[model samples]
Target: MRHTLKTLLLCLLLPSAQVLAEEVQVAVAANFTAPMQVIAAAFEQDTGHQVKASFGSTGQLYAQITHGAPFDVFLAADDSTPAKLESEGATLGGSRFTYATGALALWSAQPDLVDHSGAVLRSDRFQHLAIANPKTAPYGMAATQVMAAQGLLEQLTPRLVEGQSIGQAYQFVASGNAELGFVALSQVYRDGQLSNGSAWLVPAELHDPIHQDAVILSKAAANPAATALVDYLRGERAAKIIRSFGYQL
Candidate 1:
């Protein structure tokens, strides 16, 4: 312990001193899993801070947070969650900000399966259609809203397969367990284009805008690493990664 203290003191006195590494626990929405992983890597490289991320549906994470889970930051799939946390005094005052605006996609691993216009929904083409649980995932709510706007939710209800989170919903389609699924556009897109299979980008008008927000938890309000992580999330470096995944910055 003395030797460690001496090293820290020496470093503090040195001209080329490095900051001590700090770890932050972040609760992330499932839809942002890919980008968050990439961002966490970049953040650690840029700063000597470590990030411990937990991914789940926004509602699930929010519940855990309200129940005193020791998460330092909350990255929700919907803006509402952050606002609710703020209202409930779970987060630092005025710490919320929209990090990304998400878009939905009708994705299928089969080529030429989902037409761009989504007319395939009317036809009896596939057996299973997957969606995340609407009660938990905001993307699932958007998916149902899109179907309702297209007047196909009732017809499609009988064939629906539900996943616990948006990431799982994507898995169901990617693994071919379901023929087609309502997934975040980011899951199927990379470098400004669809990465694989067939996908129909859902029209923004069909559902409300998915404004994902981030907030620093009150429990971590004084933690430098936690604040840095939240700041890094809204920075250009992370924003670029987010856009590459097809999420709106």
Candidate 2:
């Protein structure tokens, strides 16, 4: 212990000293899983800090937070969650920001199963259509809105398969448990192209905009690593990764 202390002291005194790295605990929305993983890797490389993340539906994470979970930061699937946290004094003042704007997509693992105009929903070509649980996921709510706009909500409700989170909804399609699913555009798109199968980008006009926001929890208000992670997310480096996954800045 003495030797370790001595090394720290010497490093502190040296001009070329490196700051001690810290680990930030982050609760992330499931729809952002892929991009956030990439961002976390880049953040650790650039800042020499560690990020430990947990991914779930925004509502699930929010519930855990309100129940005294020890998360340092939160990246929610909707702006409302963070705003509510801030209003309830659970977040650091002035530390909230929109990190990304998300878009919904109707995706299928089979390349030709979905069509350009999303007309497949009207046909009897499939038995199950998957969606995230609207009570827990914002993307699921958007999916419902799109269906209602098309005047198919009541008709499609009985055939619907509900996943607890967007990631699970995506898996339902990927695994063929459902023929198609509503998911984050980012899940099926990367580098300005479709990463797999087929997708119809849900027109933004069909649903309310999905503005995802990030915040530093009051529990981590004094943690430099938490602050650094938030800063790293707002940097150009992270923005590029986000855009690659089809999220809007």
Q: Which candidate leads in TM-score?
A: 2
lDDT of 2 by residue, 35-86 (tens): 9999999998998898899999999999999999989999999999999999
Residue range 223-246, candidate 1, lDDT tens digits: 899999988988889989999999
Off by over 4 Å in 1: 1-21
Per-candidate alpha-carbon RMSD to the true structure: 4.7, 4.6
